[model samples]
Target: MIRLLACGALATVQDRGRLGALRWGVGTAGAMDTLALAGGNLLVGNPDDAAGIEIQVPPFEIRFEVATTFAVTGADCALMLDGVPILPWTGARARAGAVLRLARRASPQAWGARSYLCVSGGIDVPVVLGSRATQLRGAIGGHQGRSLQAGDELPLGSPDLSPPVAGTGLVPPVVALPLAVDGLPALRVLPAAEYECYRPVSRAAFWGEPWRVTPQSDRYGFRLSGPTLTPLEPLELRSHGIVPGTIQVPHGGQPIVQMCDAQPSGGYPKIGTVIEADLWRLAQAPIGARIRFIETDWDGALAARDALDGWLSAARRALSYLRARSTA
Candidate 1:
């Protein structure tokens, strides 16, 4: 078990996400940086979809009740264990009563919005529906179906495999992952059903210009501030099924990209949908950061998805090989 010593209201238990429930009006709310969660899980030999703690606000701390192996991934926060510095995106062992601290990111370049903390086993949370992910809107899953608070005691699942050595770690192969631009991390978007309803200029700007994520954004949606995306005419659309990454333009012309915690359906005009492969970038993108949209075809989107899958497969194999050599 681990105890939340300092962090409260900024962290929650999450898994891959509750999928296949959207048909029943449930939104899929999970870790914003799923790749980081998956990477952290793989580091500790947990299944890719295993439950872990999702840390959004930083300067967080936790104490281990029992000695165990753990990994910290996502934002490059300056992490320390009992005052000894530890590397981000790496796994390590801690003794009983060891206090783990994650300070505010030391470098401006490393200040991502979220991070993942994975233990040797995983966060032992009851699985609601088909996932352990928290659906904040419905308030029906995760740790007590709400954000964690100070003094919260979370149970740890029993490890399925041997724990890594105290210093065992792996550097994330983020370079091999998909990105829009070199450092800007462009998100590939596919035209939605109402794509053609917008003016030609609005459509062009949507693809060509950079949009800044507004402060109004949250887990449910990102209200982007950019060139007004005016529809050719006033569009009164009926409520229809919407998924994560769905970019909807309301009457105000600001494009709001629905995220993991978004409602199952919406009535706004959707000019495009950001491909799933690049949603992590958006998740990590800090407020006021500018991001570009790369218009892509269906084939390109599928290829991108394949690329992500390939990366995950290769990463798992590499970790397995390393573990074998280490054990030998």
Candidate 2:
């Protein structure tokens, strides 16, 4: 068990998110940076989809009620265990009553917005609709189906007796599998159903210009500030099913990228959809950050997904080998 000493406003318990719940209009409210969650889980010897804490608004502090192994990943931040600095992406053992705190990045230029804290046994949140991920909209999953607060005590699953060796870590996915455009982070986008409705210039601008993530962005969607994307003709579409990564251009001409907590259906026209493989990159893009969108096709999207799978597979194998050597 672990107790939250100070949990910022947006921190929540999440796993890989609820699958098949979209049919019931429940959005997947998983970790914003899933690669980070998976990496942290690997370090702590948990399954890839194990539940963990997604720390968005940081300065989060927690105390272990029992001795346990844990790891922190995602945004590069100042992590301290009992006031001693612990490196990001690295796993370490914490004796009972040890306090762990995470703060803003020491370096101003470090790129990332969210972080993941994974333990040897996952956070023992009850499964709802086949997932332990927090569904803040419906208020059905996670701890009370709301953001964590100070003094909240969370349970943990039974952990492996032979835990992975402390200090094991992985090269963050951002560094290991980089994707950028003109020196800026980028997300590959495939043109959507309404792509052709936009004027030629609008289409050109969408591909060529950098879009700034506005302050209005949140778990529901990223409201982007960029070139006004005027359509060739005014469009009015009926509400239709959408998913995370759908880029909707509203009446204001600004694009809104649906995120993990977005509604299942939307009425706005969609210009493009960021591929699933690059959602993690966009998830880490901080407010006021400018990012580019690389135009891609179905084949390119599939290829990118495959690359991400390969990276995870390799990490799993490498961690398994390390655990074997440590126990040998």
Candidate 3:
């Protein structure tokens, strides 16, 4: 068990998200930076989709009630165990009564806006609708359907093996060593159905200029502040199915990139869809950061996704092999 000594401003329990429920009007609520969640889980030998704490605020504090292995991934939130500084995306064991604290972002170069704290077997939150992730919009699932607070006692899944060595950890290459173009990280996007509705210059500017993430952004969507994109003419449509990464242009002319907690359907005009593999980059980008969008074909998008899947598979296999060797 872990005691929430001091809950941050916006920390919640999350898993791989409640998949296949969009048809039922439930958005897929999950970790913003999924790669970080998977990295933390893999470090501790837990399933990649296992439930963990998704922390957005800093100076978060927790007290371990029992000895167990844990991993911290994503943002370098200046993690310290019992007051000793520890590296992010690293694994370590905590003794009973040990206190773990996370402060503000340590550096500008670090990648991520949110940090994940994954325990060995995962947080023992009751599953709701095929997921332990918090559905904040609907106020369902995850620790009584709310964000964690001070004085809350969160249970841990039963450990089947002893804690791994303190040095065991994995560095996510996606963040530590990012792929860049012209010294700027970019997200690949596929033109959506309404792409042609926009003026030719608007479409050109979308790709040619950089967009800044506004402070109004949250889990629901990122409201971008950039060149005002104007359609060739006013258009209207009925509410239709939409998914995360769908860039919707509202009447205000700003583009909102739908996120994990976005509604299943929307009426806004979608101009493009950020490819699945590059969505993580947008999720981890800090507010006020400028992001460039790169246009890609369907084949290119598929190839990018396949490359990500390959990396995850290789990481899982490597971690599994190390575990077996250690036990042997």
Candidate 4:
């Protein structure tokens, strides 16, 4: 394992995100930029579920302890390998003491939000609630429940393994985010437990009005302000399990979309939910942005879920082919 010197806005290990144990009150805490994380996983042949780093904007740097290949994706950060330009969404070889830097610029992919960097070998960190993702609010997962700071060290899990720098993208990583992602998608969700209690007017308004993002949003959730929604009965429900993208409407009638860093259980009544496929874009949303929900029936949701399954299977196959070709 190489010794890593944290130089800038580095955070702890993340992956596709923590899963399964939410029933036990665990948050699906992980990388905000799921697409970028998967890109790194594909480069290194690690399963997509492996942990990586969710980096902030530019001036991101680190020193390599051992020889290995690493990849960075997400965000349009100005990237430098030993102070030279590099490309994101690609992999490169670094010897012991080699430095990596990501500087921000104007691009669409990694813009104004979370990005991901993955080492050939995953980082070895303590697991909480069966995940390495840091849940800051819980103060449980990740590296002591905080972001990485300068001078801090991270342990690489495997050191003996080395693969030649073999990838389609440039070495240091291109300082730009992927421009196209099919645009922001309308989240489709079935009504939550209290869906029936909403007045007809409030229910219609939910699918009708355009909600703008609130500045007070974070990993906890996105607070949106729009429309005047009223519950059929003004009764409060007990706090229960809340999933990522679940829309909970409180007293103001505005909606809050719970995110990766949201609490496991919430007291507010959840009116609707976001479609899972649309979540990646939502994670990158900036403040004061507009979003709308496109209502879909249960069958449509099932079709979307199945499509994702197909895509993941194809991705796994593609990775296998890449590794096999590189070795041959």
- Output the number of the lDDT-best candidate: 2
For candidate 4, write residues 156-209 as lDDT tens digits.
Answer: 666333433455452211122222223543456677777778899888878777
Clashing pairs in 3: none
Output the TM-score of candidate 3.
0.96
- Residue lDDT tens for model 3, 1-328: 9999998777999997889888789989898888888888878878766899999887689999998889898776788899998888778888999999988865666666888999888998998888999988878788888989999899999765444556676757565447565666788999998999999999998999889999999889999999999999997989999998999999888899999888989899999999878888888878988888999999999998787777778767777777777788
TM, every model: 0.96, 0.98, 0.96, 0.85
Candidate 1: TM-score?
Answer: 0.96
Model 4, residue 218: distance off in Å is 0.9
The lDDT values for all models are: 0.85, 0.91, 0.85, 0.70
Q: Report the CA-based lDDT of candidate 2 relative to the real structure.
A: 0.91
lDDT of 4: 0.70
Q: Tell me model 3's lDDT, rounded to 2 decimals.
A: 0.85
Candidate 3: where is the Cα deviation over 4 Å? 160-164
* Candidate 4, poorest ten consecutive residues by summed lDDT: 172-181
lDDT of 2 by residue, 60-103 (tens): 99999999999989998999999999988998999999999999
Q: After superposition on all CA atoms, how large is the RMSD of candidate 2?
A: 1.0
